[model samples]
Target: MLPFYSLLLIATWLVPKYCLVQLNEPFLYISATTFKFVLTSTLFLTKLKMKMSKFVCFITKKLQNLSIFVNPFWIQICYFISVSSVGFLVLKVLKPRNKSFRPNDFDVFFMSVSATTVSSMSTLEMEVFSDTQLTVLTILMVLGGEVFVSVLGLHWLNSKFKKQETQNKVIDPLVVSVEDLRYKSSIRYLSYVVWAYFLVIHIVGSTMISIYMSLVSSARNVLKNKGLHLVTFSMFTTVSTFTNCGFIPTNENMIVFSKHSGLLLILIPQILLGNTLYPPCLRFLIWVLWRLTKREELNYLLRMNFSDGIGYNHLLPFLHSCLLVVTVFGFIVIQFILFCCMEWNSEALKGLNCYQKLVAALFQSVNSRHTGESVVDLSIISPAILVLYVVMMYLPPYTTFLPRKNDEQSLRSNEKMKKRREKLVENLLFSQLSYLAIFIILICITEREKLREDPLNFTVLNIVIEVISAYGNVGFTTGYSCERQLKHDGYCKDAWYGFSGRWSNEGKLILILVMFFGRLKKFNMEGGKGWKLM
Candidate 1:
């Protein structure tokens, strides 16, 4: 660790200096931070891809030979931890030189882990970081989230694609089996299109945001003479937004762009599409469209042979997609109705017109689903709404979002499948509630003294919101920036909303553990759900 840390320090110190000089030249192609982000993202992605490939091969060969079983839940857990550890170390090595305020080592590590987990909790203000460090953080967000895992799935999918291609060349042209067709369709629709889809969205989204920023002098000036193109802001915003990692270029977050409807339009779609169940949803959507259009070429490409009856296996992805859609839809509707019924005239939504209020409701509802970007200060919301948020975050529906095909060919009974699904849901809910209890308890015990000293700021409600945010990995806060509090020898007089920036080291450690556990549990439980669905 010593040698590795030394090498990282040397690189971090030297690389920026060299790149700064190069970037000063008029003809240079890219900024240093962007270059670092690209280089690091590529490196991590390649390593992860190779590891996944080797693991898959090992499972197919060695594990099968030994007649031993290894659960995907454990495999996913290991993958998450390994990638996150590397990501944290990289952030530590590439620590920012631009001192907004000097951050302790734990702050950087916490941010790195949060980004890797795709949980966007911030322990420090984001605006203080150097561009190079911020770019690294953005890359970590993308790589740490669904994008990296999806790419690994694509690596396995490549072999599946080749196998299907070979099968397509068969002279008999027998009807494709349900499983074969599902794989082929998923590969064609998801594997092939997902990257292109993201690229197109990024280009369009960044353009929209940059254009909006240009119209605002405050945002435009931030990019001025910084060797950052107008598009750079867009790129960073696009990636972070789509990954649902709640990082913002500014410390104030989306509050600065609260009135910007164009930005909202771009963000909402990205958040919706980035939901954990999107891949499976996409597969089902394409399948439906092919059926509606009766496009022979599409059907041929997807290798869809519908001669056999559509089995429950074929419908699982579609069912999962439908459930996700309903879940999000139901949540938004319910939240909006409550907002109207309860806090219609509250300061949070007071000045806004009816239309703006509705839009605000929609945004907050979507955001509550762990998207983390906030347009409104959460502190002012009624206790009822806050309670609703706690519930939404603690038990996000994405925990059971992706379903895989079952291997119960021997006992093809609908009754058995129904029972299995019920059991799976029971286990998921139980685990989530249990974890939530543990997090809340730990936070309470750790912050007892702090709560006593500053009851107003560290009230029970504030503690609950903060704990849920940490456990849910959502970064929404009432504004308790604790960096100042922790720095001073005495308690700070400021009423900055949100959790402790000034918390004891022990308190911060509890939040860190909760955040990590939340992220790790998400992947493990979600993957386990998919396995059970199969």
Candidate 2:
């Protein structure tokens, strides 16, 4: 009876969406179902709270006990699964606004996965989505993109409390070591600070984007419900930039905002700080400011070391700061210089003035590293530029190197640290390279017939770019067509001419796997036990 009721309630909530797609007389059925379930659930929950139903109370208690297994790993996995599932369900429920060119179930699921993974790949046109659908995509981005250190910290806290004995008051082995305790403490503090940090960054970035959008008369006219549209667009840009989830609301993406320097200004720093590099860069900034102020009290706070009053733990963060800054900036400068020298007169940059070209180069460099957004068309770029992008994306996140402990005991500890760092880098490289390799192999095998049929339409470079995009989770494509032959007959001309929409089901499945691995590998690399402080 309980199981039946629960399933009924769930179905009732979903009926409206399903009805819109399937049934002609949906409203009557949906409204009746909704009312019945709502009334029944209200009565049952109310009665259970008043101790009128022992069965309901038992079920509630069981759910409470089961929640103990909810850790960060499972939470992340669940988030991915939930987003995909909800997206699949939504697509199944909603009827297409246009009768002619309705997206199949798989197409919806693929786009959902792309959005949830932040891969920025899309088979269907984004410009056609209703406001409700965009809202759903935005929510998925927020959930999937942002790092949930807070949830991780809370789980740690729960584990700690659960381990305490009422009589013996024994400390668990997990938290017994000083280093372990310190790590846990750091996580707790980080979890607390991370939300506030995200809020501040988003507010600033969104404000700038909003201002830029308002200043542009054309943009204002195109986007109706000015205030709401600005906020929605700002949220999309903010999350997309900061989380490195590069799902642009508009089809044109950064190209539309090319003239808006104010928007680019916001995007540049957000991309730099939003990627894995942000933490170290932030620590460096704080340290520099503290040094200039020369405030001894603030030094302790900034260092994030409450127990060690000597400020000895600053070494790791300092080193991290230096390494990230030099590596990222160096790569960007080299790439920008190369772009100017090699592709100065390319079609992508032909319309742009010198300043705009410089900005475009900078944007591409930053975006290629992780964020995946692009102001210029990647398809038209020279091989040199494409190679640069591949290299940048292939390199692990700038913050991949784990700094050695400040106070090491012996040569063994130092050697252990070195080996751990090496292993981390190795894992990162292997993770990305393996994905790229598999994707390439699959493309060749699955797309062999198609390639032979239309050699001009499907080139090796097109496939390589797609694989790189998937493996890096960068989402930039050479606008490859989905079918072997150009079905549109050159009707829709965009830089993404040979984009994901044209890929076969088998090819898309392979890329989906690539995106999953690209995202999952990061979580696996970060979660493993190699980072334990000595």
- By lDDT, the best candidate is 2
Best by TM-score: 2
- TM-score of each candidate structure, all chains considered together: 0.69, 0.70
lDDT of 1 by residue, 167-276 (tens): 76684456567667655554545444555555555556655665566555665565574434554466667777777777776666776556655567668777776664
On a 0 to 100 scale, what is the lDDT of residue 280 in model 2?
Answer: 70
TM-score of decoy 2: 0.70
What is the Å distance of residue 50 in model 1 from its true position?
15
Q: What number of backbone clashes does candidate 2 have, counting pairs of residues 3 or more apart or in separate chains? A: 10
Question: Residue 460 of model 1: what lDDT?
Answer: 77
lDDT (0 to 1) per candidate: 0.61, 0.63
> What is the Cα-based lDDT of residue 176 in candidate 1?
60
lDDT of 2 by residue, 44-139 (tens): 444432442243234324433555775445555665776677876876566543546577677788878887777787777665455567766765
lDDT of 2: 0.63
Error of 2 at 153 (Å): 5.5
